[model samples]
Target chain A: MRAPSKELTIDEVLGRIESGMTVGIGGWGSRRKPMALVRAILRSDLTDLHIVSYAGPDVGLLLAGGKASKVTYAFATLDSIPLEPLFSQARVERAAEFREWDEGMFQTGLRAAAQRVSFLPMRAGLGSAVLENDPDLHTVRSPYDDQEELVAVPALNLDVALVHMNRADELGNGQYLGPDPYFDDLFCMAAREAYVSTEQIIDTAGLTVDASLQSLLLNRTMVTGVVETPNGAHFTDCTPTYGRDEKFQKAYATAAKTPEDWAAFHERFLSGDEAAYQAAVTAFREEAQA
Target chain B: MSDVTRSEYCAVAIADCFADDGEIMGSPMGLLPTLGARLAKNTTNPALMLTDGEARILRGTPPLGQSGDVTEGWMPFRLVLESVVPYGKRHVMMGATQIDRHGNQNISAIGPWEQPTRQLLGVRGAPGNTVNNRTSYWVPKHSARVVVEQVDIVSGIGRARAEAAGPAATKFHDVHRLVTNLGVFDFGGPGHTMRFVSVHPGVTVDEVREASGCEIHADGDVPETRTPTDGELVLIRELLDPTKLREREVPSS
Candidate 1:
C-alpha cells in the first residue's frame, strides 16, 4: 500500500502543541528558522512554553509575547547583530527561566534525546560555570580503567519539533540546499512529533533531482507533517531563495527598543496571518524604495 | 618596516599563538584573528586547517568575507561539535567581553547571571572550546571594564577552575594566548595569573596596569610587541585585507 500523506496547515500544526510543552525549534541563529510556525504560536493562546533552540528571533518573539516560561539555549543571536535585542531585554528583566549550555553540550543533549538515551557524557561543560549555574547537571565516571569523570548532559526531549527547509514532499521528506544542515534532523529525531514547513512541496522523486543525495536531511519517518509556506523564513535567511531581509530585521530590532515602538511594529507587521505578514513586508520594501 | 599598525602587530601576535600548532584547526573569531590565522597559514603554518566560518574546510586561505575557489572537506556544525572538539585537534581564538587575571573569560552577561544589567552573546562555545582544546582570546579594546578582577560569569575555564575540575578537564585545557590593542598576555605567572608578555609600541607597562582591573604579572621590563615583516605586511595588505578593514578594528596609532 502507498504511504498516507502527512501534509498540515500552519494552524493544524499549532493545534498539536500544548501549553507548558517542551518545543524544540530548528535553525541556528537567524538562519533557516520556521518563522511561519513561530508566528502561528505567537498568534495562538499558547502560554507557559518551554523552548529549546540554537535561538534566533523565535526565542525573542516568544519571550516578547510572554509565551515561554523557560528557554534552554546555547546562544541567541542575529549573526550580523551580535546580541538579539529582544532576548537581551528579556535577560535584563529576569523575564523567564534561562538555561544556558555550552554549544557542544546543547548538541550532545539533543543527540542524547535522539538516541533515546537518558544522558550522554562529554567534557564541554566541565570547569566552567555552565555546571554551577545549571546545578542539576551531574558528572559520571567512566566504567573503564581511565576512569575519567565527565559531565553527563541530560537528554533534551521535546514534545514537538518545528523546522523549515528548502523543499519537502507531501509524505514529509525534507531537503535543504543550503550550506549547513545544522541540527534540524536531530531536533526532529529528539521530538515526539516533528513538523516541517518548506518553500516548496514537490514530488518525493524531485527532492534528489537538482540537489545531491546528502541534501535530503530528513526522511519521512522523522517528520510528522509538512506545510508549504513560501517566504516562511523571512527576516532570517532562507539562503538561495532569499538572503536575510536586513532592512526589515533592522526595523524589527529598532522597534524592540521601546514598548510603544514594539506596539507600532506589531500593528504594522506582526498582528496578522502569514499572508498578511508577507503583504506588509512587500509594502515595507516598496516604502523603502520610494 | 617601522611603520607597522597596531592591528598588524596584533595579527602577528595572534599568528604566534599557532606557530607550534602543526596540524590543528585554526578557528579564529574576529577581524584581526581571521587575518592572523590567514597570515599564519600563508607564512609560518602551512599545515594549519581553516574553515570558512560556516561548513567547508578551505583549500587555501581566502580573503576576508570571500570563500576561495576550492574546498578540502565538509565540517558542518554537528561534526565540529561531535568530532573536532572531542578529538582535541583545534585551536580557537575567541572574543572576550570580560576576562580576569585567572583567564576566566565571559561573553555571557554583565551584572549578574540571573538578571543581568546587560546580556552579551550567551556563552556560545567558550566553555567547550576552553576545556576541549587550546583556546586564545582577541580583545580589540582593553580596559579595566573588560580586563576585570573576575568575569561576571565563567564561560571559559581558567587555570584555577581547570585544576579544580581535576585531570580530566586539565589534560587538554590550555588558555594559550591573549592579544589586545594594548598588549599580549598569557596565563604564565606564578599560580597562573595573567602575565604581560609584550606591550604594544608607544604603550607602557604602567598603561596596561592602569587599564586592567586585576594585577598583571610583569617580572621585569616587558618587551615591545613585534612589528610585522615586509613579507607579512604585503600578505596582510595585498592578499588578505586589501580593503584595509583591519584598520577599522584596530586603527593605526
Candidate 2:
C-alpha cells in the first residue's frame, strides 16, 4: 500500500462512489460514524446505494433520502437520538424490506461474510414479522435433526466498506479509542475493498503499544485503496480533539424532526462550508455558554 | 386460525399489558416504550415520516418486556433484521441504577443491595449505545440512590463534552425517559432535564414524592395507564420476551 502522492478533500474521495454499489459504513450504534463521508453522500448525486451499518444518523440520512436501495445490518437504530422520519414511512407503508435475525445471529451473518462463507444459520428469525414479510429470509432446517426449527440468512459480502479510524498509519493500520472495533473489522473484511477514513494519519511506530492493535489489522493486501480524509466521520464519529457536544445534538434532534426539517437542518448545518458549519455551531455553543 | 389473526385476542392482550398496578410504573411503562418507538420514528428522520390521513398507533414490542410481563432480557422483533438493526429502531427504554431530575441515567454498579457493594453489569452498552440509541430509563426502585446528583461514570451519551474527548468518546447521545417505581418522566426540558409526566395507579403523591431523588413536575391526580391494545400485545408476544427464554407451546391434557 503506497501513500498517496497528493492529499484530497473528503468530498473528492466520495465523488467517485457509484450507485447500486454495496457500501459498508463503520460505526456501531452512534460511535465513530464516518460523518465526513456521510455528509458528502448527503450532498452527492449517488442517490441509489446499498449500505450496511450497525446504526447511526449516516444510515438515517441515506434511508430517508430514498438514496438507499437496500441495507443489510444487525440493527437499524438511534440512541437517545431523535427518530428519523424516512424509516417511519417505509415501515408503515411496507416499502422497505427487513430481514430478521437475533442480535448474535446478525453478528454471525456478518462473520460468515468476513470468513467468506456462503451463509450462516441461527434461530433468530423465528416468530418475527420480518420473517413473515421478507422473502429474502428463509428457513434452514437444523442439521442435527433434533427440534426442527427455522434458521437461515443470506451471507452479506459487501463491495466496499467505508471506515473512519481514530488514527491510522500510512500503511492503513489503525486504532480505535472506543469499546470494541465497532463492527469495522468484520464489515471491512467482508467487503471486496476497504476505504479507510481516518481522523489523522500518523506514523506506525505506536502500533504495538496495545495488544488489540495487532489483532485488528487486516493486511494491506486485503485492502484495495486507502483514502485519507480528516474529520471524515461526523455526528457519530469520535475524534479525539472534539468530543460530542450535547448542545449540538439537542439542537439537531430538535431542528430535524422530519425529512423537511432535516433538509432545512442540513442546510443550516451540513450544506455550508466547514467554516460556516464551524461558525454556526460555535455560535450555538457561545449562546449556550452565555 | 392463529391467535393473532383474532382481533379480539389481540385487543384483550394489549389491554392487560397496559393495566397499571403494583409493579413499579408498571402500566404506562408497558404503554410508552411502544409509543416511544413509534413516535420517536416520526421525530428522528422526517423525510420518510408518514402522517397517513388516518391516525394509527403501531403497538410494537418495545425490545424488552414480554407481552403480559415486565422484565428485561428480551429485545423487540423489529431489531432482529440486519437492516432494521441499522435503520429501524431509534429509541429504547434503558434500565438505570441511578438517574437525575434532568433525564440522565446510570447503570454502572450497585451498593449494598445485599453485600456492602454490588458490582453491577458494567455499562455493557451504556457508554456508546445510550447516546447513540434513543434512550429512556426505567428504575424499578424509587429511592435516593436511583435519583442522584452527577453520576459516578457517565457511560451513556451526554450533551456537555460527552464523546467529545474524540473518536474514542461516545458517552453523550440522548436521555429521554426516567420511569421510576412511582411514575413516568420525560426530559425534553432546558438542558434536557427530566420532568414528571404521569404517575401509576395505587401510587399516592406522597409515595412518588418520597421515592423521587430530584425535583419533579408532580401531577396531583395522575391517570392510570391505558389498556394495551391487542395489536401491541400481539407484537410483544410474537416478538420480544423479556426473559429471553422462548415461550412454550400448550400441552394436551
Candidate 3:
C-alpha cells in the first residue's frame, strides 16, 4: 500500500474537504472518539456538510459547532444524552436539518446503499410512527417490478470517514481490541476516504490472526491514512490495555455545557498539532504521576 | 452505593444515547405524563400500554420500583420493570441477529438454530410482529458482517417495502429509527436520504463508516451527542425494562 502523505497537520488532512461531502465517524459513548480530526474541522469553518455516525460524543459537537447540515445515524452513545439541544437548537435556531431513526433501521438503510439497489424490502412500517411522523421513511413501488414491499433509502456517497482504533498499520489497516467493539470498520468501508488514529502501530500480520471483529472487518485497502496518536482514543477504553478516564469525562461533560465553553475546550484538547497534544497529555500524566 | 441514585442514573444514561434534538422511544423521557410521554403520544391504539403500567398518564410519573424474587433457574427476570413497551409506539428499538444501515434486523437463525457463526435467540418477536411494530435496532458491535451486505434472512424490515405474499401490510411501513454504539440516525428528511447525524463522545467519523455495511450521507463536521442527565440514568436503569445489569432493591435501614 502507498504511504500516507507527509503533511500530518489536521489542517492538511482537512484542506481536501469540500462542501456537500458525506462524512462518517467512529466512537461510542465518549469512548475512542477522534478528537484531533474533529477539532480540525471545527476550525476550518465548513458548513452544510452531511454526516454519518453511530452512538457517541462527536455527534453533538458537530452540530453545536455549526459544521453539519444533515445527519444520518444509528445510535448516539451514552444512556441519556438528550438530543434536544442539537436537533431542536441546530434546526430551529441554526437552520440545520436533524432527523432520527430506530438504531437498526439506520443500519438497514446503509446496507441498501451498499448493495446499490433501488430500494430494499423490509417489514419496518408496522406499528411505527416513523411511517407517519417522518415523511422521509415511506413505501414505494418496487423499482425491480418484483411484487415485493420495498423501502427506498437514498445511496450514501461519502467524501471521507474518520475512525479511532487500538492499532493501525501504515496503510490505515486499523485494529481495535477493546471490550466493546463499536462499529469502526463498518463506517470506514462505507466511506470513500478513511482516516485512522491509533494507540500503537503493530505488525500487520497479527491483524489477520486476531480474533476480534475489528481486525476482520478491515483490510489494508480500506484505510487511506494512519497516524500514531497514542492513548489517542484514550479516556475511552482500548481493552486489555487502558480505558477512558472517568475524571476527564466528567470534567469534559461539565465544561462543554455551552458553545463558547465547547470552543475553548476544543482549543485546549484538539487545537494543536500532535506534538502539542502529546505535551499537554504528558504534562497531565506527570502531574498525576507526581 | 451503586454510584448515582438508580433513577438519576437511568435518566442521564438514556438521554446520553441520543442527539440533543433527537426523538426518544421511552415513555417518561418522550414527554411529561401531563403532556403524555413524547414517544407514547405517537401511539394510535386507545388500549395502549404505558411504560409505567398505567393505560395512559399525562403527568408521566415514574413507575414504582419493586425488584422481583428470584426463583430456581428461570434465568432470574429482574424486576427492573422499565419497559420500552411504552415507547412501543409505532416505532421501537429491538435486538437483531443481523442489521444493516437501512434499519433492517433479524433475530432469526444465522445458520441452523443450534450451530451458527453467532448463536442469537431465534425469531425475537420479528416474524409477525415486525410487520406491526415500527422497529429500529441497536448493534453494540459494528462490523461488516454484523452490518452485512444483506441479512441471511429478513427477520424484520429495514426499508419501506410491502410484504410480497407474506403477512398483509400494516398501518405503518418500516423502522424509522436506528441507533448504534456510534451515533443516532433516521430516514432522510426530504428524500429519505440516509446521512450521519451525530457521533458519540469519543467516536470518530471514520469508525462509523467502516463498520457500516452501506454508504452513509456523512458530513465533515458532524455534532457530538451530549451526556445523559442524572435523572435519565436512573430511569434507564430502573425503568427501560432490564438490560446489562440487575436493578437492586436496597432494604430501608
Candidate 4:
C-alpha cells in the first residue's frame, strides 16, 4: 500500500495556525523563507503570534503588520541591509516582547525540542549578557569529576513550522538545491506540525534524479503538508532558482522610514493577495528598468 | 615599492593574526579581513582553511568576490553550527558596533537592553563565537563612540566575563587581537584592559588616545604599523583585490 498525498493550499495551511501559537520560521537571515504563507497570514485576521526564527524580513513583516506579540530569535538582519528597519523600530519602541539568544544556543534550543529533551547544556551563553538580559535561562553543573558548568538552553518547541524549499513531492518530501540546507530540518522536527512551500512539486523519483541524495533535507514523515508556490521566497534569495530581488529589498527597506511611506508601500505592494503582490513586484521591476 | 595605504597595512596586520594558526578554520567577516585571510592563506599560512562565505571550503584562496576553482570540503550552515563551532577548531574575526576596555563587544542594541535607543544586529553569533572559539575584532573606524568605557550589551564574552564563567568557559575563550584602522590593540594591559600595540604611519599615540573613550595603555615607546612587502603589495593589488574595494573601506589620507 502507498502513502496518502498531503498537498495543501495556502489558505488551508494558515487555517491550522491560531492566535498566540508559537511558530518557527525556517531560513537564516534573508534566505529561503515561506513568504507566500506569511503573506496569507498577513492578509488573515491572525493576531498575537509568538514568532521564532533565525530572523530576517519575516520577523520585520510580522512586526510591521502587528501579527506577532513576541519574537524569539538569534538575530534579525536582511544580510545586505545590516539591520532590519521594522524590527529595529519595534525594538526601539519596545513594541513587542523579545527573547534573544546566542546563535548556537538558539540552535541548541531547537535541537533540544526536536530530541524531546527539557534542556541542553552548552557554553555559548555562560557569562554573557544573554543570561543577564533573560532571567529565565539557568546554568547547570556536570555530574562528573570535572563538574564543569554550562548554560542550560531550554527547548524552543513550536506549534507550527513553516519553510520554503526548491522542490517537494505531493507526499511532502522536501529537497533543497542551494549550497546550504540551513536549519530547516531542525525546525520541522522541533514543531508539532510542519508545512513546506516549494518552488515546484515534482514526482518523488525526480527529486533524486538531478540533485544529490543529501539535498533531500525533509522526509515525508516529518512533514504535515506541502504547498507548491513558485517564487514563494521573493525578496529573499532562493539560490539556483533565483537570487534575492535586491531592488525590491532596497525599496522595502527605504519605505520603512516613516509611517506615511510604509502606508504608501502597503497600498502599492502589500494589502492584496499573493497574485496581486507578485504583479506589483513585476510592475516595480519594469518601472525601475524604464 | 609603491606607497602602502592604511587599509593595506591594516590587512597585513590582520593576516599576522593567523600566521601560526596551522590547520584551523579562519572566518573573516568584512572586506579587509577577507583580503587578510586570503593573503595569509596565499603567503604565510597556507594551511589556514577558508570558506566561500556560504558553504564550500575553497581548494585554495581565491580573489575577492569570485568563487575559486573548486571546494576541498562542504561546510554548510548546519555543519558550521553543530560540528565546527563547538569543536573549537576555528578562529573568527567579526565586526563590533561597540567595544570596551575589557574587550566586551556589542553588536546588539544601543542604550538599555529593555528598550534600545538604536537597535543594531541583535547579538547574532558573537556570544557563541567568543565562548566556543578563538575570536578577534575588526573595527574599521575607531572613535570614542565605538571604543567605549563599557559596552551597552556584552554580545561577545570578554576577559573579565570569561573569568567569571570559570575554567570550562576560559579553555577555548581566547579573545585575541583587535585590528582597527588607527592601530592594533589587545587585552594584555593591567587588569586585562585594552593595550595599544602600534599606530598607523600617519597616526600618533595622542590621536589614538583622543579617539578612544577607554584608557589605552601606551606605557612604553609605541612603534609604527608594519607596511606590506613588495611581493605582498603585488599580491594585494594585482591578485587578491584587483577591484580596490579595500580603498572604499579605509581610504588613503
Candidate 5:
C-alpha cells in the first residue's frame, strides 16, 4: 500500500541520475560512502555533474573520471590517508568549480533545505574568508540585535542523494550501525529524491533492537529506493563491523598519484562490475594472508 | 639514556597547548595533535574529556585506534556536536596549511576562488570551531609557505580578526596557541598578533624567523621548548603511541 518495497538494482538507482544535476553523496570523510552506487555512476557515461558531498572517494573518483563539473563540500579527505590526491591534482589544473564551505555552514545549508527554507543565518562565516570568497553570499543583521551580522547560507537542495547504511528494511528504513551517523539522514532529506544502499535488508521487526537503531534510522518516507549490497562501503570504512581495508586504500592512494597508475588501478578495481571488484578484493586479501 | 628527538619535543609543546585548560572536550585532529591531547590527558589535565576514538568518553588514555570492549559509556557523535560543542567547552588542535601573523589559518586553498591552484580540505568546521571553542594549530612542517604574510583563504578565524567581527564573534573566539615543528606561538602579543613563545631544543630564534613568512614578534630571548619529561616519554612511548607514528611526522635524528 505504502509504495511497497522501494527496492531497485544499483544500475536502476544510478539510472535515476542524469547529467548536469546536483547530486549529494553521503558519508563522512572516508567512512560509510555509497561506494557501490558510486561505482555504478562511474561505469555510466553521465558527465558534467555537480556533486555535493562530505567527500571521500566518491568525489575523488568522480573528479578523476572528469564526470564532475563542480564540487560543493566542506572537506575532501581520505581520513587516515589524508588528501584525495586526484582531487588535489584536478583542482591544481582548474578541472572543476569548487564551492567550499565550513563543515557547519555546509551542514547548515543542508539543514535549510531539509527544513524547506530558502536560507539560514549563522555566525560561522562572518570572521572567515567564506563570505569574502563567495560574492553570492549576503549577511543580514539581526532585527533584535542590530550589531549581530550573520552570514546567510543558501539551501542546498540536491537532485538526488546517495547514501550507504549498515542495514535497512524492505520498506526502505535505513539504519547505521556505527558511532557517527554523520548527517546521512540530512542528505536524504535535502535531496529531491534519495536512494539508499545497505549491507543487508532486514524485516521491519529487526529494524528496532531495544530502540538502539531508532536515532540511527533514516525515515522510510524520505528514501525513494533501497538496494541491498553487502560489503557495499568498502575501501571507505563501514566501522564497528569492519574497519577500512587499509591495504586497498593505500594501493588506491598510491595508484591515484599518477594518471597511468590511476588508469591501471581503475581497470583492476573500478572498471569491472561489483562482483569482479569483490573477487579482486578477495584475491588481494588471500595474497596478503599468504 | 639517549636524547629525545625533535618529534618528542614537538609532542610536549603540543601537550602544553591544553595544559592551562581546566576541564574541556579536546578534539585534536591529525597525528601530532592526537598525541599532544593524549599526552596532556594522561599527565597534566586529567579532567580533559577524552574519547577512545569511538563512542565512549574515555576515563583512561587508551591506545590510538582501539575500539569496542573498552569504552566507559556511550558518547555518540550527536552528543559531542550538539551538547559538547555548543557548551564552549571544547578545545580542538588541528592542522593549518597556511597561517598568517594574526593566526588566520588557511586549510582551504591557495589560489583564486573559482579555480584554486591547489585545493586542500574545505573550511571543514574550522569557522564554527574557532568561533565556538578554544582552537590551536599544529603545523608539521613550518616554513615560509606555511607561516605566510596573509593566508590565501581563511578557514579558521584568528584572534584580531575575530575580535573585529564583534562581541558575538569574540565571546568564544580564543586562538590559544599554535605548536609547530620549529617552535611554539601564541596570540597574546601586542594587538593579538602571533608571537614566538619558544623554540624547540635544537631550534634557534633565527631559525623561527627564517621559517616564518610573516613578521613574528619576538621581543625577548625565545627559550627552547620544554622537552618531554621522563614519565611523559614513557607514557607516550608505551600507552599513547606505541607505533612511534609521531617520529614520522617530524622525525628526530
Candidate 6:
C-alpha cells in the first residue's frame, strides 16, 4: 500500500496554530522565512503566540498584529536591509516576554528538544549578563570536572514549526538550493508538528539529481505536512532560486518606520491573501515600468 | 609618502588584528573590514579564509554583488560553527554600539535593561563567538558615546570577566583588537586594559584621548597606522569593493 500523503493547504496549517502555544519559524534572519504561513497567521485571529525564530518579518508581523505574547530569538533583522522596526518597537515598549539568547545557545536548545532531552549544557552565556538576566538558567557542574561551570540551556520544544524551502516532494521531503540550510531540520525535529511550504514541488527522483542538493533535503518522517507555495519567501531572500525583491523590501521597511505609513502599507500589501498580495506587487512593478 | 586614504589605513589596522594563525577563517562583519580581510588574504596572510558574505569560502576577492566569484570550498554556518568556531580556527571582526575600558562590548541595548532608551539587535551570537573564537571590533566612529566608561550591558565578555568564568570559557576568550577610524586599540596593557596601539595618519594621540570616554592606556609615542601597499590598494578598490563602499564609512581625506 502507498503511504498516505502529508499535504495540506496553507489555511489547514494555520488552523493547527492556537493561542498561547510556542511556535518556531525556520530561516535565518530575512532568508527563506515561511512567509505564506506567516501571512495566514496574520490574517487569522490567533493571539498571544510565543514565537521562536532567527527572526525576520515573521516576528515583526506578529508583534505588530498584537499576536505575540512572548518572543525568544537571537536576532530580529532584515539582513542587509534595515532592522525589523515592529519588533524593535516591541522591545522598547516591553510588549512581549523576552527570552533572549546567544545564537549558539538557541541552536543547542533546539538540538536538545530534537533529541528529546530536557536541557543542553553550553558555555556561551557564562561570563555575560545573559546568565544574570535569565534567572531560570542554572550552571551545571561537569560530572567529570569540578572546575567547570556550563550554563544549562533548556530545550525549546515547539507546538508547531513553519519552514519554507526551495523544493518538496508530495510526501513532504523538502530541499533547499540555498547556500545555508541553517537550523531548519533541527526545528522540524524539535517541534511536535512541522509544516513545510516550498517554492516548487518536484518528483522524488528529481531531488537526487545533484549530490549537493541531496545534502540540503529534509527527511519526510519529521514533516507533518507540505504546502506548495511559489514565491513563498517573497520580500525576504530565497537565494539560488530568486534574490530578495529590494524595491518591495525597501518600501516595506520605510512603511514600518511610522504608524501612519505602516497603516497605509498594511492595507495596500499585507491586508490580503497571498494571491492578492502578489497581484498588488505585479501592479506596482507594472506602474514602475510604465 | 604613499597614496593611502583614511579608509585604507583603517582597513590595514583591521587586517592587522588577525594573528598569523595559518588557514583560519576571517569573518569580518561590515564593508571595510570585509574588504580588509580579503586584502589580508591576497597580500599578507594567504591562509586567511574569506567568504562572499555567504557559504562558499572564496579563493580570490570578488566584486561585490557581481557573479563569477571564485570559491575555494563551502564553509556554511553549520560547518563554521561546528568545526571552525569550536576549534578556534576563526577570527571575526564585529561592530559595537558600546565598548568599555575592560573591553566588554554591548550591541544589544543602549540604556537600562528593563527600560532601554534604544533596543538594538539582541546579543545575536557575540556571547558564543567571543567565548569560542578570536573576536575583534570595527568602530566606524570612535567617540565617548561609542567607547563608553562602562557598557550598559555586556554582550561579549572581555578579558577580566572571561578569566573569572574559569577554564572552559577562557580557553578561547581572545579579544584581539578594536580597529576604529581614528586609531587601533588592543588589550595589551596591565590587566588587559584598553591600550592605544597607533593613531590614523591625520588623527593624533591627543584627539584619541579626548574622544575616549574612559582612561585608555597609551604608554609612549604612538605612530601612524601602516599605509596599504599599492598592490593591496588595487585589490581593495578594484576587486573586493569596486563600489567604494569603504569610503562611505570613513571618508577619504
**Window of ten residues with lowest summed lDDT in model 4 chain B:** B60-69
Docking class of 6: medium
DockQ of 1: 0.89
At residue A206, candidate 1 shows an lDDT of: 90
Give the local distance difference test score of model 5: 0.84
- lDDT string for model 4 (B113-206, tens) is 9999999998888888888888889999999999999999999989888899987788788999999999999899998899988898899999
TM-score of each: 0.99, 0.52, 0.52, 0.99, 0.92, 0.96
Cα lDDT tens digits for candidate 3, B80-153? 11123212343444555577545556553354322234323233235333565455555444566777655654
Residue B3 Cα positional deviation in candidate 5, in Å, after optimal superposition: 3.4
User: Candidate 6, DockQ to 2 decimals?
Assistant: 0.72
- The ten-residue window of minimal lDDT in model 3 chain A covers A79-88
- Residue A118, model 5: lDDT of 91
Q: lDDT, candidate 5, residue A237?
A: 94
Residue lDDT tens for model 1, A38-99: 99999999999999999999999999999999999989999988889999999999999999
lDDT at position A273, candidate 1: 96
The reply for model 3, stretches above 4 Å from the true place, is A1-12, A79-95, A125-127, A132-134, A141-150, A206-214, A258-267, A281-290, B1-253
Chain A vs native chain A, TM-score per candidate: 0.99, 0.83, 0.78, 0.99, 0.96, 0.97
Q: Which stretches of candidate 5 lie over 4 Å from their true place?
A: A1-3, A209-211, A284-290, B1-4, B64-70, B73-83, B227-230
TM-score for candidate 3, please give it.
0.52
Q: Which candidate is the best by DockQ?
A: 1
| Candidate 5 vs. true structure, TM-score | 0.92
Candidate 1 chain A weakest lDDT stretch, 10 residues: A234-243
DockQ of each: 0.89, 0.03, 0.04, 0.85, 0.60, 0.72
After superposition, the stretches of candidate 1 with alpha carbons farther than 4 Å from their true spots are none
RMSD of each: 1.0, 20.2, 18.5, 1.0, 2.6, 1.8
> lDDT of each structure?
0.93, 0.52, 0.51, 0.92, 0.84, 0.85
